[model samples]
Target: MTMSSVEDSTQAPFVAPEIVTVGELLRRDLHIPDYQRPYKWTVRNVAQLIDDVDTFRTYGQYRLGTLILHRDARGNLNIVDGQQRFTTFCLIALYLAKHTSADVPDTSAAALPDVGLEISKANVQDNYTYVSESFGSRRGDLSHWAEFFLDSCEVVVLTVNHIDEAFQMFDSQNTRGRALYPTDLLKAFHIREMSLEHASPQLRLAMVRLWEEIPPESIHQLFSDYLYKIKRWANGQDVPQQGFSSEHVELFKGIKEADPSNEKNRWARPFLYAKNYTDDYTQENSTLIRYGALSGVEYPFQIDHPVLNGETFFLMVRHYYDLGLRCGLFQDDAGAIFDVLPELKPVLDLLDAHRRMPTHQLVRNLFDCLVLYYVDRFGEQSLDRAALMMARYAMAPRVQSKQVRRAMVNNYALGRSSARPPSTNLFQELRLATRPQEILRRVLASPELNGYPELHCLFTTEEGARR
Candidate 1:
């Protein structure tokens, strides 16, 4: 459905909510939409649900949770939220019907639908196997438990006629229960934005698949460790002590191309032109550029650029993910540093060998962030010199102080420490520099070289060799 129809539905009156038992809820036809994320609930989640049913069976009617469904024009109930819980419940029902003599209806087991997506299918099989094994062990108690689960467990069913309202309600309701990561909310928001652009269903499904391919933890680290810090530091703001959260999602949500105001937004012209040119070039050159150098042509994306909403946001994420892998930012090994900046091998080796303390780790993170920002802005031009400059700047704070805290790193970056003069925000300098030599030429006050003997030798020796 198009977004206009969904947007208009917000003005319509709300439908009355209904409370239904698990059996009654399962009897109705349910559908899983393509835009929804894959089933991610593990065995622990399944066991918890089973345990909750057993613990609260004698406590009168127990509420399971809420389900927000969209009733389409064809009268199908498309699950907008609670797909994981709903699918798990279906597996439980099927297991009970097979293993117990409980008075469960035949239709409950018949409602189990086949999932098409590979990730969801694998999870479904794994969860079902766990359910079957759990049911087999509790053979004597299965009958009564099945009866209580089918009849006593209830859910608050809030069904809306429009897709947008369903998602809005989903977002509103999810705040209290198992908290969703900020990335999850971004996924949902962009899907809605894509619908507003009238993106084809095939295109939407492809984008979702591309997102699901990345491990969720890697994505979390990408934001928490690198992107979030660089964005805040470059803007001369202190990084949040509590880490990234839902409040900061707007940082990544930029102009929507479909908005009418974009036509008059002069600032958006360069981004839109680049996007259009890339699309046309790739399509036209798909056959001719099969091998060699031309095959790797990609949209020019910078870490500090304005994020285009919907599909481009997803592509930007993929670009950074590949970049992180190539740079070895996610792991302890700095061997990959040679690939881009071979000149930094001695410096990296010194840091890797001697910088093993927890405080040293903070300095390493600072070094990585600087190199990432440099490559993002200036490409490979003068990369070795730039990396050395960043290394010297990031490492000096650790050597100057006996005990380093997070605030010390922040102070060094912003030039607030007593050891350095004020007005030396390194990231801001990198952002404003027009050429590589500008960064290479900038200097910092040297900390006492005797504080760390090996690092001292490396720095002084490198300087001697350069001269």
Candidate 2:
């Protein structure tokens, strides 16, 4: 009877032991086992590995370590442990292979260089032997894994009776030294299994670029020191960091800390405002709508929103951007924001007046003014008296959340009756205005501006009276 290639069930048990490059390992579809935990390697960890290899010639010789793999029922080498280290090594290898000429064909074997040439040749050779013996008898198909491990790398494979042992081994290997963050572990899971290998680079690159812009030092410091502050705040205790949920706040902190300060680092903070830019391709669709809104220079779409996703962030950014543009709010770039500082001075002063007020309130008030200015300019009804009173009451201590308080100020500016409940009179007044700027000037010069305890005069009148 014709028999299969390996019909010798009773023949001497043979194992294929061999060395391989990372390429082959990857080609085999070799990956962490289902029972294996996610990749917990942080950006710092990755950065260090690359930095070590780049800076120290022999860095690869000593062998950072190895991983043990066993053939699963599917005949695949399921990583039992050392997945993080292995993955990191593979990443570095891929980067090096791309950056260097090691993978080029038609080159002499003598010219092909080892990744860890700085390591003693003897140590490198020993590393090769260690990897060779660990793969059992399947050496022929392991050229890729071998090249990476033996060339100043070391890995060992062993058969295990159960998956629990593998997990314990994994935990033990990764528990010490630099602590791996849970968020970082989550990142690995998202990157390896959750995301498609052939995913679009545009989205990923944009996320990475934006994340990189957040000052690394600031992220690290916030995680290290201020993250816990939110916990206390959430628990109703006084804490430094405010406005974030305790659990999420701490999680963000941990991730921020896990990110590397090293130059070789990859990955970045998840984009908090990624949706902002992605949602609108043009500056006109942005929050400010006008190019030269805040800076008065009409800088095209200079708005910077924390890269977040979905409609909430989209609308939020849109509203804020529009308000800032209309009100000419300047955050940075002194030359751009400098001119409007005077107009925003009262808003800033009112915000500073209350120590206990929430941040959203302050920002809201600022935006309300912008909306008022916009509505007055474009709306059929000029909200004269209401606009005047709105500006007047905005000077009050409690006028935070400029948006919520906007209607109030708009109603008051018309001056139908400051205390009157909601009525069509306010809307009608908004319609009848001839000059809205006149109302704006009156609001700016009203008793609220002059009498505001915190207000300070920048310029003097002809008679030297408070202007």
Candidate 3:
């Protein structure tokens, strides 16, 4: 829970870190910055904290963890890190003050902090409910335990004036509890990147709200299952067996739009033009008569296109998240596909109804990634034909082999196979293709489908239509 610090001799006098009890720390005005990740501690996390406090009540002093604070010009202490632990402590204080006979300070007598994000608010409500029930069930006089909790539980507080220094410390500190996810690290990185543009606080808050609205698990899956695989496979690289991790984050961190060199670079022209046009059109035409038709014009985003760093990165995630929903990757009902592309229904329905063995599921993932990539590149142009092509390409391995592994899937993606000459790598083809026919023209070798009559019929009908 503790971190090592070095003192600077040339700079202004260093503010010494202080060790304060939970009660003492709660007396200060604490704030959670909008750019911080949503509170994600679960019920088990709360219960564990309570148990730890009870276990060490008689040990004189129990250090909770380190809290990094960035003190703003107005003297408000913004939580740069450890907001999760700090928030849990606040909940405990509130529960004890209302339900127990603990001599809690008057400063701690307050309502729960209003959390703006839905995910954080939900966790706070759940954790509070657990705290109330757990505290109420405790036996005998509980005032002493409460007193020990408030007075004995300690945390090392490190206060800094600059946000960058606070985050640097956060990155270096040894986290004692839940580990930060790769998504969390990405959020922090993009938020810092946005800061360089001096983005307005309201705009920053809006961006965070947009991010927090989506379920965290969905975002993780979107990156790990679809985006990561598509990026690697399109480049003719083997996808890691372990899927996406922190090492792969750099793939998403492309050129910063604000960088002078990149802004002037020829490669950034299309992205910059799209962003500017979208912004200008929305601003000018939003209240006009044609608003309905033109107001929601978005930055043209492609899955293979270079990711613009900062705000656009958030937009890119949202863009694909909505796409995933429409494609029925996150939902159970296939109705969404009917709404957007009725042509994909038969293939998607057949896949959904089939037995989902591990290998089968891998093929399913491959199909989903291809459909997503095709749509991303060409929109609805020849979408039905593109979908059939993707299905044939993705499902070939599943039908040809009874036991398909990760390597087999990867090889099939790269057009490497032993049974026949290598087929066209559809992903690579899509990356190079400007027109749908360029991809649709590539012929697929039909797989031996002895047991899968439905698939055989699907391929036969598609081939017949082509002829």
The local lDDT score (0 to 100) that residue 440 gets in candidate 3 is: 84
TM-score list, all predictions: 0.88, 0.27, 0.87
Q: Between candidates 1 and 2, which one is better according to TM-score?
A: 1
lDDT of each: 0.75, 0.36, 0.76
The residue pairs in collision within model 1 are none
Ranking of predictions according to lDDT: 3, 1, 2
- Candidate 2's residue-wise lDDT over 1-467, tens digit each? 00011222443232343454434344444554332333444555655664454354444443354555654334445565566666555544443443344442221111111212232244434433433343445444344433443354434444432333333444444445534433222222222221122324343333323323333333333333222222222232332222222233223222122224422433323332232345344444555545544321221221121222222222332343444444433233332432332434454454434423553343234234333343524442334333334433444323322333433433443333244232222223333445664433432332322232332221122311221
- Model 1, position 423, has a per-residue lDDT of 28
Candidate 2: worst 10 consecutive residues by lDDT?
106-115
Weakest ten-residue segment in model 1 by summed lDDT: 1-10
Cα displacement (angstroms), candidate 1, residue 121, comes to 3.3
lDDT of 3 by residue, 293-390 (tens): 54477889888888887788889899999987766577533323324367677677777776356767888899999988988888878777777777
Candidate 2, residue 376: the lDDT equals: 28
Task: Report the Cα lDDT for candidate 2.
Answer: 0.36
Ranking by TM-score: 1, 3, 2
